[model samples]
Structure formats: structure tokens, C-alpha cells
Target: MTDHTPSSRSAARATRPVRTKALSALVHGICLSLLVGTVAPAWAQFKASPAVSPRIPGNRSLSTELKIEGMQATTDYILAVVNQEPITHTDVDKRVARITDTAPAGSRLPPPEELRQQVLDALIDEKVQISHAKTIGMDISDQELDASIENIAAQNQMTLEDLRNRMQSDGLDFQRYRNSLREQMLLQRLRDREVNSRIQITEDELTTFMKEDPAAQAEVALNVAHILIAVPEKATQVQVAALLSKAQAIQERAAQGANFAQLAKDNSADTKTKDQGGALGLRPASRLPELFVATTTKLKVGQVAPVVRSNAGFHIIKLIERENSAQATYTQQRARHILLRTSPQQPAREQIDRMNDIRKQIVGGQTSFAQMARQYSEDGSGARGGDLGWAAPGQFVPEFEKALTALQPGQISEPVVSRYGVHLIQLIERREVQLTEQQQREAARSVLRERRFEPTYEEWARELRAAAWIEMRDAP
Candidate 1:
């Protein structure tokens, strides 16, 4: 994690963009796919280790093992400390360089020393979060971490050897990058448990906000999906020409109403997202990359955009759903489902067969869904007859959402496989509501959630740091 900058990269090879996952961190690991939110391309699940181990899941315990192994009394400078953990000048310098390297070109950046302080603050916050997550016994297994790396490689259209060689050539220590990755996943897991789980919005608050807030009521949301035809760096003229042709073909197929998700799964370079058909989740335009925002401006729901090129490569985009708050209205589905979880004992096929029979029982009027769900559903909703309640778009994951969209009221769907398990879905009824009470609450709940997330998390960070024994060492 020394002051290694991609701008000064030594690698002659360019990494391809994998538009797999989205977050506000360094993503893509390439020049082409850079966007406002860092494009995350890996997911590792590993057991937590020492303070240093949480940074990266690799076996190299550099923080503890290498700190003094080859040290000199005068060369290594102390920068800061949190508890007994030390931060070296090298740490500060690396972060400063990373920030500088990743900043948008032509944007005015602060002095390196000033950026050092900000980076230091961020590191301290990260250290506190990692410490907390470790204390709580959250760990990602090495196998899981390897899977993340594999996905990263796969998404970039490279093998693990290729990725390692690229990193080495770029003057980045591969082991150090893994450590950075580990810290990232650890922090994300902590937030999911501590911060994300606690925030809640009340029904009363939603009703009040909907009635009173005019401007807030008019915000728009777009549900977009994309396919990346990634072009590797330093591609030959012929290579670029072929990629353009491929992108054009994909775009043409999309416009002619080919199954976009299937196309994405079959052809998308970003494997992390191919399974979900490149679903980016539901988000506002403000949260999206400007390129996407502009591309979708004239597009309609269920419509496809022309092949759009960026630094990364060409994109075949689809506008899955969109909403205008000013004229906000949605058809809410009152639905319930019975889940037959795929376990070692039952397996996926058995679960599917069982679910089919359950659907038949309900459809054939042998028994009510609620009774069946109450008797057999493995999830909490079983007690309520699998009543998931009313949901607008984005309430459920994409697989479930897509299924729900297809069902007419009182019609049952074939067993659908989601991450949760196999489900037999029945849409009880559907109604179009204009700022309905339930709609307002759900929206306000989400709005309030977004409002509380950042500041609350910051406050939480400060609290953790406060509780730690941190000391600032004079920079030499």
C-alpha cells in the first residue's frame, strides 16, 4: 500500500472494465471504467483476523510480520496510532497518492499534505470499524475471499495469473491490494449489521411528509440495467473495430426486443452482474453516472439505448423501470409466497418439485396458500400465511420483482428461484394508487433512510474513534 499510483503505472497492459457492482469506492481497477461510484467487481467472504488481517484476506500478515522484520531505526517514520496499532508515514503517503490518482482529471485537488489529513481521518475511521467488526466475531473465510478474486479476474476477462501479472507490472504489490480489499469487505459487513439494520421510518412520518412536501414529492427514479462490451487497454486498431461491431450487434438485438437479461448473461464481460442481468438496482439519476443519466434521458421503460461508449468500453443499456415523483403513482401488488429453502437434505430440485406440488394444491383448491405456508414455509412470513404485504417496485430483489410483474391478480407463478429459495408466488390483487398511504410510508421510509445513513454513520465513526486509544505522531 505504498504511494503506488496508476498514473505512474509500469504495466504496459490495460485492465478491462468489469461493470459488475457499484459502490462509492475504487472500482474497475482500470482507466476506462472509472465513474463517480467506484465499480466494485469482487465479493470475498473470509473469517476475520487480527487488526491487520481485516485489511486484506491474503496469507501475508505484513502489518504484524513485516513491520519490523526488515526495518531500520531512522528510515521508517511513525505517522499516527489507534489503540496500540501504528500508522506509518508510508500508509498516509499511499492513501494520499490513491486519492490523487483516482480524482477526476482536471479537478482541483488539495495539497498532498492536506489530503494526507483527510486520508488519515478516513483510515482512522476504517481502523475503528474493522476493530469493531472483529470484536463482534465477523469474519470472511479464505475460500470466500478467493472467490472474490476469481470474480474480479473473470469480470476483467482475465485469469488469476493475468491479474497478478498486471498488478505486478503496474508496481502494485498484489498482497497489499488484497489487504485493502479485505478491509473494504469488513467495513461493508459492519455497516450492514450495525447501521443499515437499525434505521427505520414510521408510517406516520411517511403520511406527513407525503402530504406536506411538494418538491420532495416530485423526485424521479430509474431502474436501469446494462451490458458492457469491455475493450482492453492498448487494443489494436482491429481489436477496437471488432468490439464496436460486437456492441452494435448487441444493441441491435436489444432494440429488436431480444431477452436483454439472457443476452447479458451470455455475453456480458462483467460476470459479477451477469446472473442478475446487469441489474444496477433502483436508484435516482443523481446517484447514477452522468453517462448513464444522459443515455437514459430520452429512453422509456422497456426501451433500449443505442450503443454508448465510455473510457471503459461500449454499453448496451436498458431502462427497466422509471418513476416521476411529481406524477408518482404505482400499481402495488398484494402478494404472498411459500418458500421451500434448498438445503443439503432436500436439494434445489426437490425443493422445486415440492413447490410445484404446493402451487398445485393451492390452484386446485386442495388447500389454501396460507394454510400451506403456515404448515411448511421455512421463513417468518409463514405465520402470516406468507403475506409479504404490499410492495411497489424495488421492494424485492430483481428475480422476484420480475416474476411479480408478470402475474395477473389471483394467478400463481411457477416455482421461481431467488437467492432466498424456491418460491410459489401468488399475486392476490393489484391496485394503482396515487400517493397511497402505504406508498408514502415506504417511500418516506426509504427517503428517511437515505437521509439518516451518511450523517449517522459518520457520527458512529467518531464515536468508535473516540473510544479507541489513538495518538498522532509528529511527521518527520
Candidate 2:
């Protein structure tokens, strides 16, 4: 993670900003989504059926059920061993079950034998990586582990106690669950350190990437105001024609110098932005819906586009502003957040409830946001009225970023759960800025790193597995 230095006004809370990191992609890939499946205990039921082949010692068929010591009676056997660490038949079954359960609807799976071999290979690779992580003295602290568990609980909308009780109800040992989480964290840390260190992006590569990347080339920011004449679902053709006529008339009025804002305020059906003069605010072309971007692409400022029909209805759009510069620019946001750190002492649900009340008070004008933040926020930013200064995309974690993007200026978001803690975020404002030369290079570097992360990780894992002593025991 890279630390962000706050502006002079908020310098006292310089360290309070949630640092940005290139590992956000990896976090989502290896930590958040994977942990949900990897840590959850799966109980596989192996029904008694006729065996296709005779069961040999140390070579049990899939249908064979054998009682194992210190565990429930189930069909289990040693499948492989990596550095003396055994992978069991039960482990494979559980993994297979998870894959099957989580597979997208209508997706096809490989043949059973092929799938089993693939799962076994993946298990061996995991064992090798875990062994290497431990060998390198990489470790996850108890505090970090606790935070990760809390994050998982928050993501599931459960309190810490609720998570514990849910796990117990599912017949999973709490300590075992914690161990699984720790392992995942260790794996994430290991990959971030090792894989990132291997990637190198040169100035030439950066320049080429900037030129060749389609998104980078078309770096345009747009501010558009729209008036929607909504067409109700299953409406008659006459009703549709009437709505279309209304939209065309509004577009004509807007083009003929009628007050667009007033027209939107009075006639626009989009409740969220209608009162804001139908302004969608400044956003990059990538952030705006494709329909809006397409309609406004060739429009000059103050020009009104012809009425366009969509699934929702007809839209009369005005191009408020367009920034299509030679230099890449993006919409940056200045947001402030009141963070409440969650722990066993103050569970997530309690903190969430508290944040809700605080939001209500601030919204109702009973208390100022800054005052409440100063009184209740746990982070150093509290001293600076919880200001997180100007930030570009990818500066915050994905969960935080998603919530921040959804809020308008001065709008406080509902309690947002991130790995760090729960936060009540208020977007201060947004601005469009051209990236400096150095900033552009840095942005290119980030993109290059993301592109390299996956392949580098795979190569690193393969190397670890090849160096380890892997023995395949039973072939099933």
C-alpha cells in the first residue's frame, strides 16, 4: 500500500487516508471472493454404492467409505502428499462440491476424472505455496486475522458473534475457521510481495501502453443533463407514441433556448437527478452509461441531442460540458468519512447501527457532520473533520470506492463495510483534472502491474510446486 499525503489543511491527519495499493485486484481475486468459499466448511456426503473396482490399501475407490481417526466416519483417504503434508480424499470432495455449487447456471464441468485430477493439482500447488510462505517467515498477525474475519462477517451482513454462531451451527470448529482465514491472508501477502517484486515496467512500455490502450486514448470526461419521458412497461403503442412526442417536444424546447433545468425539474421522471436539473454530474466516458456517451459524443456544449429511446423511456439530453483533451483526464472526488473501527468489543452490527443514527442526526441538521466525526470517529482523520482530501480512482479499496461513486456531492452514504472498518462516507465534491506527466506515468505503471500480476503469480506458484517434494498416492 502507498501512503497519500493530505493537503496542508488536513496535514495533521496525513496518515489517516486509506492508502492505495496495486494489490486491489489481487485482494478481490485471492482474498475477498476466494475466502468466502475456501474458509466455509463443506460437508460432503458419499452415498454407499457398488464399487467399480476392487479397493486396495492406500488406493480407495470414490465409492469406498472408510472410517478415519479423529474425524467423522466418511469416505476418505490420502490422495497426495506435499512436503509431508497430506491432501485427503475428503479435501478433494469438499473442493469439488464447492466448485459445483458455485458454478454459474448452465455452465458445463469437465469429466469427473479430469476434474479430480485438476483439483488435485491445484491442491498440490496450494500446499507448495503455503509451505513456501511459512519457510520465508511470512506470517499473519492475530489482529490482522481478526480484522479479516470481521470483514467477512460484515460482507455477509452478520455481526462477529453471528458469524461464530453460524459457523458452529454449520458444524465447523471456530478455531479451524480462523486457521483457514489465516492461511488465505498469508497466501495473499505472499503473492503480493513476491509477484509484484518480479514485475518491471519501463518508460517505453508505459508510453506504448498509453498509446495503444483504447480506454487511455479516449480519455474524455462529460457532464450531461437529461430529461426522461418514461415509457411504462407493457404500455400500448399509443402511449409510447405520446411519450415519444413529449420527449421530442422537450428536446425542441431545449434546443430553442427554453430553460433545460426547468424543463427537467418539471417533466423529468428520473427522481434521483430530476431535482438536480437532471445533471448526471461530471464523469469519465467509461463511468457514464454507453447510451448517454454515444448520444453526447458529437454534441457541442449547450447543444441538445435528438430524443433517444431506451428500455426505460425516451431521453432528451443536453451536453453540459465535454473535456476531450490530448492529456488524459479523469473525474476526481474529494470525500470525507467517519470511520468506526470494528472489533470483538464493538461488533459490526452495533457500529453500523451507531453510524445510522449519526447519519440521521447530520441529515436532520441536529448535529454537524464534522462535530460528530470529531467526537466519534476512531481514525486520525477525525481531528481534521474526517476529510480525506482529493483522490483519483483506485485510491481506496473496491468496497469503499463503489459506495463513494454512488453518492452525489454532500450526500452521505449508508454505512460502508471495508476491510479496515465500517465508514460513513460523504462525498465533498468532484472535479475533472488532467494528469501530470509524472502522474500519467505512475498510472501507466499501475495498469502494467495489474496486467502482469496474474501471469507472474502463476509462474511463481509453478516454480514453488516444482521445487517441492510432491508425491501422488492414490489415482481416482
Highest TM-score: which candidate? 2
lDDT of each: 0.61, 0.66
Query: Over all chains combined, what TM-score does candidate 2 have?
Result: 0.63
Each prediction's number of clashing residue pairs: 14, 0
Candidate 2, residues 30-135, lDDT tens digits: the string is 1112422111112111112211110111100011111111223467789999899998887776666655554432234565776666666666766787799999
Q: What is the C-alpha RMSD of each candidate to the true structure, in Å?
A: 14.9, 13.2
Residues 234-333, model 1: lDDT tens digits: 6788998999999899999989999999999988876556789987877655456679878998988999999998766778999998877446666677
Q: lDDT winner among the candidates?
A: 2
Model 2 Cα shift for residue 273 (angstroms): 24
**Candidate 2 segments exceeding 4 Å error:** 2-74, 208-328
- How well does candidate 1 match the true structure in TM-score terms? 0.47
